[model samples]
Target: MKYPVLFSPIKIGTMEVRNRYVVPPMATGLARADGSPTEGHVAYWAARAKGGYGLLIVEAAAIDPLGKGSPWDEPGIWDDKFIPAWKKVTEEVHKYGAKIAIQLHHAGRQTTHDKIGGQPVAPSPIPCPVEREMPRELTTEEVYDLIEKFGDAARRARDAGFDAVEVHGAHGYLIAQFMSPYSNKRVDEFGGDFMGRMKFPVEIVKNIRRKVGNGYPIIFRLSGDERVPGGRDINDSRLVARVMEEAGVDAIHVSAGVYASTQYIIAPAAVPPGFNVYASEQIKKVVNIPVIAVGRINDPLLAEDILESGKADSVALGRESLADPELPNKVAAGLTEEISPCIGCMQACAGYLFDSTKSNISCLVNPFTGREGELKVEKAEKSKNVMVVGGGPGGLEAAWVAAKRGHKVTLYEKENVLGGQYRIGAIPPTKQDILKAIRYYITMGKKYGVEYKMGVEVTDDLIMKENPDVVILATGGVPLVPNIKGIDNPKFAKAVDILEGKKEAGTNVLIVGGGMVGVETADFLGEHYHNVTIVEMLPEIAKDEQAAVKFFLMERLNKYGVKAITNATVREFLDDGVVYEKGGKEEKLTGFDTIVLAMGAKAYNPLEEKIKGKVSEVYVIGDAIEPRKTLEAIEEAARVAVKI
Candidate 1:
């Protein structure tokens, strides 16, 4: 009722979505090694459906197993054997009155030889700038085979009871490779002119229509702008929309970016929200069919506004859905504040997909993302007195869930604010979204009856006086103070203090440590017209940061005239500047200003050693266990909370 247009039913060909909330297909890497749908994958989609999403466009399925997109295992529709397993997902989604669609995809040259078990195949023998591996050019007959494969996948999807099928002609995949001049340079019919390049997808669409008949919805996911030189631009995107319409496709779901423009694909917090809506609007001008605008449409009000202004017919929530599956239901119920916001950290959703250690899709804020069935907060059989130390994300999550499960939970924080270092970390540019997660924790804590004791240091005496059944020490971390010459000087301040606005730097600032904190500190200072230089002992700065997020951050820092000297060791801190050694020579960089230290953090567990053995049930989490990102912190705390 609040967002009438956003909540309104809309038709995509023969299928009617219950609402305009579309969960766009995001790669979860949830399928088996053989490319079959797993129970976890089915549960992941079912949770979103039950949460009140109108339609779910499942993550890209390989039409050919050899065309697998990412190195991670993904679903496949190349074989008939996958149909029955996929049907479980559709049946579960349909039970909640939500229609589901499958995305037919191929990696093309976007992947590496190790991923697809060969030199990767594309319309042309072009190597993706990011992947750097030259792909084998597809033969004329092979191209025709792939077209039929797309048709076969669509027919299988319909047999599996899916309401629709999406041709993933976006994100620099196989279809996108054929459509773009950047990669397509063949002398064959599939390349050369715009229409020739368009012929591949056009024929694929026509083939799908012939196989699925005229009734089933066929949505073509188009990348409005590839964001790379000589790639598919908005002009080409509009023409593709018009041609796809003529080819009998039902809708256009416009996303942006290629493999090179990875920033736009996931759109980190640095990128403005709903920035790609302009592309969708441009394509919508040339097409009568529906156009769904995606890329960073996080807020529900923004989705409503986009629809109200006629910029897009439907709004897609990709990573936002992972952060909170119940977002649509919460918005429909007018409890917008309760909706868990995606901070766009890329710490989990995009982070996991790219990280070699992590293969499944998850969220930094919401641990229940890919593990939907695993991380449920069930009511306890017996209630107990739970005392949680520290008010950070991990501690807040632990206390909130414990209270929700009928435990009498009391949380204590040394600082008055609850978010701890994460809250302070939000001070940098494009990082203010981090506070949303912290605020959500605080809000949910109140809703779940969590008692808070602010600025109260829980000591051993206090713990003994009010003995709790369980004690969770999430005391967080202290800034790392490495043993360097003249390191104990009273003149320099920590990066945390600078972020907290407790300390102001001079015009010229020298920062020690070139990790995320150090780089962001430089950006924070550079924004205020300060000349900043970072010295790191490592080969690069912020090497641990998410690649795409780091790319944009580095770009902003460069604009601010921030200088970084890598493989340099800071030997001594003086009143004027720091003495550093680079290339085996000691050099003194003279500067008339503040000597700030952004030397990362170390685990602060002073109380853990003292109280661990004393408390019958004691657990330490978050930075107290080891200084890390919010991803590990929240997960560690949740794992402990469920057990308690």
Candidate 2:
């Protein structure tokens, strides 16, 4: 075997993957509210196939309407209406020369029935920890019916032209509920010991294989660890893997955690990259079939190493694929610069999915992510000159989109360089790769003939001088300074100041706010310096952040000895440390060092109304409209540019 063997073809039953790069199923909630495939879902998956993935596993589709885990609007294959819509997806994927697979799933106790309008059903009468509603337990006869539903869904997928069908048995889902002792407490045969608990998943695979016929491929996705105490671990997972292979499973797609164990499903930033690979390696040792590994397989080199070491047969990219669908294609062509890196900040991807945000999944760096087909670089009609103000995510995105459409785009920034806040953020220890994305956009701006003017702030006068047809104001936002006493003192520093090394701090530092920015900075500083404490008035740290990221932030805080206090209000700032009030007690603590404020940001809308009516078409995006994460900025900018 050679190093490039990772890209070699492999067979799973009658189906053959063109290469070992598998686009694993990630629940994007891209479907319609009624479990039907929407145009957005079709376009999203088609982009992956077009990007040269050997195998594309569609996002989880419900086997039965009652199996819905949340109100995420996931597609369903149990109904006749879904077959034609799914057939369109298969046809699109095949046209791109890629093999497609549909991952069939049931949420069990995790289901909320919000979209389908019903209560959840599970192996035992247990409710998910996060969602407190109790699930109705299914009888043995009902269990048989559910098993047939799995088969029916698989048969529908096969008839719809999907080359393979995957039974989702991981992440404490319906099948996993039967396998996990922590969730499955039923005294019956389906819930007693390991073998009995394992029986349900094995039966599903057998029934799926039988329904799909002799040579059809049936992949079983498994979670190596439940990430909860008394939950299934690697040793148990290995046993389950063997049982799946014996029951005619062609592949074992390995992932980790459940939505119930928030930290496990979305590993915290503290968890090392490729942290879950060891479990897949362990499962591979027990099962003869190929094992697919997924979990922060962001870097192509890391992914290559996993495949080269024989730890797993294939690498499944979840968020990485969303960030840049062309990663595998670019790597194969040795066009690494074209790849847009996923920052692992699940804000738009998993976070928005959970929040039910209507905007498509956006990459902080990849401006052309979800709208690849719709927002292609069509030649401009008149090739009008365009002036874009600011050099942040929004400005860069607008400039690129305009230039790609053959417009003469000029971008001006007040700073000496691009990236805005991201430039400072990239140096924040664990987030060094964020800078690479900024550099990629700079290169793209140049490649597409977008003239960039650094150190030149675009004011109303500057815009009037340019006299362009359109003016896009992506000027970003300003930091919000509180009205506290001593806030104006030179001793105080902004989080950006600390990141940029413009201000010096002692070994002991206290960050005023416990948001994501504050917490991450604390983690970075704590790793390098002596002591760091975060003071917040809220009940928890990183409350505005997604649960997945918050879990990781909390873990890093614990590891780095960073102190976090909640429900504490900062009364006043002293020369040494800030005084606080907690639980009706006023305590003044004297510290040896510097104070950094990481509260939040304010939208810089001073120029929006100023330029809107004055110009032919004025576009205000990014932090200029409202301060948010980078993904939101880039997506909004691109969306507006498409219409203009």
The numbered model that scores best in lDDT is 1
What are the lDDT scores of the predictions, listed in order? 0.91, 0.82
How many backbone collisions does model 2 have? 1
Per-residue CA lDDT of model 1 for 1-644, tens digit only, reads 49999889999999999999999998897888899999887789999999999999999999997888775787899999999999999999999999999999999998877777877999888789989988999999999999999999999999999999999999999999999999999878998898899999999999999999999999999899999999989998999999999999999999999989988988999999999999999998999999999989988889999999999999999999999999999999988888788998898888899888986999999997898768788999999999999999999999988888889999999887789988988998899998889889988899999999999988988988888899999999999999988889888989989888798888889888899899888888888899998889999998988988898899988899888889898888788878889999999877658888888888988777777777789999989988888789999988888888
- Lowest lDDT 10-residue stretch of candidate 2: 356-365
Once fitted onto the true fold, the runs of candidate 1 whose alpha carbons sit more than 4 angstroms away are none
Error of 2 at 402 (Å): 1.7
Off by over 4 Å in 2: 1-3, 113-116, 268-270, 367-376, 568-571, 579-589, 605-615
Model 2, range 524-620, lDDT digits (tens) per residue? 7877865998899999988877777676667767888988888998888888778889999988767748888998899886666666667798888
What clash pairs does model 2 have? 268-552
